[model samples]
Target: MADVEDVQVVVAHQERATVRVGEVFLKIDADQRRTDVEVEAMARAPIPTPQVLWRKPPVLALAGLPGSALGRLGEPPTSSPKAWSAAGAAVRTLHDAAPPPWPGRTLDEVASSLERECTWLLANDVLPADLVTRNRRIAEAALRPWTPVFMHGDLQVAHVFVDGDRVTGVVDWSEAGPGDGLYDLASLTLGHREHLGDVIAGYGAEVEVDVIRAWWSWRSLIAVRWLVEHGFDPAAPGCEVDVLRSQV
Candidate 1:
């Protein structure tokens, strides 16, 4: 039998919990629909993903990826530029593949959510009005129509696993669906703007820089509240708050 001492809580919040034991991960989610999407997305993704070990209601077990995550929030990446570029290439491959059958948010939906979040932030005095206003203007560029692609939806750096200069796998597919390709790119480079050039180079296609920038703001602004409520400190160095402040 596996030793109970090996278990470690990776993340825990009101809605879900993820624990690691030996070389496997156990995810417990409140909503089964999200797990359904995660299973489907992993099956559909063209790139490498953690192997699904087994599934039982509310508990999905997965084999661990081979390497450490590409990076973490609030810290500079130690991985080489080549690794960053490899992640970009992996993203491009996913985007080029057939999109997921499920629908994603429309531009109007994103705009509405941003409006609602901004109102909450302002009413609660969570951030300065000027900071929110400036970032909102920057986020406008992303509200334009976009061609849909298979998106990881939460392609944050920590979700990507790398071995040396190659991408080994990507995880966390709960939000995967047909969405803007640039949003994935933006998510990968959110707090690591210095790596944007290397990632864009590896993406190997013409992309609109301004639109990517717009997603940075949109993602950061919309995530602050969720991050806080989840017991994460968005105000920590190199986090969502820093990403917003960097625009100044």
Candidate 2:
């Protein structure tokens, strides 16, 4: 394996960079990059994001926050509750800062993208129809009532960085979109009940987390179905099927 440091890894998980007009430009991974660019641009955010520092087609300058891809607790505070409160506040600040409307894509466009990805998964024989149907149900429920808000579509602990209870930064900008806040919450906790409960309690919002938890449970079941049908690899870990089995 190549060292990430030696390679000057400007962008990863997509492809290599190319040069044009004596300057390096990154080729956008059409499957992913557009949403990242749009969401960051829309936010016009104060916090530094990777998308804003575009170099060229596939390259961008990194902000050099000293953390791993899975985030780091740079310093430990004396109290966990205090640390949790501060981290929650930081997340609220980021979400409350509104972004511009994502220019061209409509709800229909997003639906189409979902369909395409689901179709691709099915074609590859990597997922099951039962999972697809369940995913659709959860998605529809999430979208049914609320107006769209900016969502970190794939939020997780890995994207979060903390320095002694203070949030230093959020790392990935890809897979961002306009969607339900709870959807973002679901992704963030990834069905970890305790963690999800902590985040909800910390937020202190009026809304019930039960609805969100329901969505998360349903969504998680879909994921488990996919993994089971697809055949698990030794490198991957999941208990989604176990959770579903308990429910049944």
Candidate 3:
């Protein structure tokens, strides 16, 4: 509470906004339940996470991690293969740990949303119908049942932080819970397929890579309209649109 001069707005949407004041990040959320889940999940996760400084209803303060993000959706990774491997290892650790008390999306729920989103895409002509159709077919493989594990339900690459070859911590834990582990894997490597092997190498190779690819399609396909609504460009190079196109 000293003389805080600089205030940086990190991200803002209708649902939430994150502002950074000095080294502390203040997350203002609309839903108290999501914030509750985030705090609890971070406490439960075996892997590194941000330190919770305080919480005041809509605003939660977290101490910033020590490293840059692993990468962004439409950007080339600055972290090395070793760092990506480290991230994968950390994810594996989280998956092996006992899950939280809360629930995550079921397979049926995911499939239903995919169907609705696909219909919206078609109606709006958001993408070429054939492209949508083809990726939808590819995405079908991910619709099957999975053994649940503790999932960082939105494991985007930007949420992971690293320094050199070491994973410093992960952030944005509102979506963490029991869910498909491969979904987490797919999310972390989305738009960054080249690093998948390095991740698998560290994670130990019981994974079905084709399933990972399928989830990639599924995730990208369902995400397009949401991105558009959220003022993000899914069609950006190396982003969600490119990810869907790369299915073949």
Kindly report which residue stretches of model 3 are placed more than 4 angstroms away from their true locations once superposed: 1-4
* Candidate 2 residue-wise lDDT, 153-197, digit = tens: 556555665566555666555556556666666655552444555
Candidate 1 residue runs with Cα over 4 Å from true position: 1-5
Supply the global lDDT for candidate 2: 0.49
- Flag the better candidate by lDDT, 1 or 2: 1
Q: Score residue 7 of candidate 2 by CA lDDT.
A: 31
lDDT of 2 at 173: 58
Candidate numbers, best TM-score first, in rank order = 1, 3, 2
lDDT of 3 by residue, 1-248 (tens): 46756999999878899999888999999999999999999999999999999999989999999989999999988889999899889999999999887778898998998899999999999999999999999899999999889999999999999988999999999998899899899999999999999888878758999889999999999899888998888999999999988886
Q: Pick by TM-score: which candidate is best?
A: 1
Instruction: Mark the regions of model 2 whose C-alpha exceeds 4 Å error after superposition.
Output: 1-39, 46-54, 67-85, 103-140, 214-235, 239-248
Which scores higher on lDDT, 1 or 3?
1
TM-score of each: 0.98, 0.62, 0.97
After superposition on all CA atoms, what RMSD does each candidate show versus the true structure? Answer: 1.3, 7.0, 1.6
Q: Which candidate number has the best lDDT?
A: 1
Candidate 2 TM-score, true structure as reference = 0.62
Per-residue lDDT of candidate 1, residues 1-248 (tens digit): 54565789999998999999889999999999999999999999999999999999899999999889999979979999999999999999999999998899898899998899999889999999999999999998899999999999999999999999989999999999999999999999999999999999989999999999889999989998998898988899999889989976
Report the lDDT of model 2 for residue 48: 41
How badly does each model clash, as a count of residue pairs?
Answer: 0, 9, 0
